[model samples]
Target: MPAEPLATVVGLLRDKFDLALPETSTELWHGHPVWLDDDLPVAGFKAYPTFVTVLFWRGQAITDHSGKLNASGSAEMSEYKLKSVDDFDSDLFDVWLQQVRELEAA
Candidate 1:
């Protein structure tokens, strides 16, 4: 489990995403929490000194209609930086999660 507020955020994310992708598995990857599709990493979260970052491994391919992803000029990855759980947007996150699953399936 994560520490304090992070745990709350993680719980919310897990609950929401698990319902959408029942087969997804979560584990610590390089000390960061990650949701996996079989052996492939679909999404992950890392707690930084400045903020918590949620990562989409193949996010570059997914169209963010909400324009929430922080591009940071990365090619195959994108991330959302949140200072707290209140910054987490469930609807937008779901759209990204669904798109990633479809991309992985393809």
Candidate 2:
């Protein structure tokens, strides 16, 4: 982990982090990188054999679902994933940021 694992994940989250509050931070949760706001996690990430897990918290908060949040490939996570760097889409990242905002607000 030349850069930290969370750092790597946050680098990915960087695509969606701006819209959320500054209180949001990253940590290791069950050996995964997790993002938190006011102590409540907004998202988490993990890299498996063939994919990655991008777990969005406040998962219970999203009421009006629109936009893209994918959990494809073999990460097998219950939340969304981007699997590869090529999958990082700004529009979808914006959606994830929106979810982060909603979570922080709660």
Best by lDDT: 1
Per-residue lDDT tens digits of candidate 1, residues 26-99? 88888877878877888887776546778888888889987878764446888888777888888888888889
**Model 1 lDDT, full chain set:** 0.79
lDDT of 2 at 96: 54
| Candidate 2 lDDT tens digits, 5-103 | 434554756545634545677778888667787676667767665566666655544543643454433543236655556666666567656756765
Best by TM-score: 1
- Candidate 2 has a TM-score of 0.63
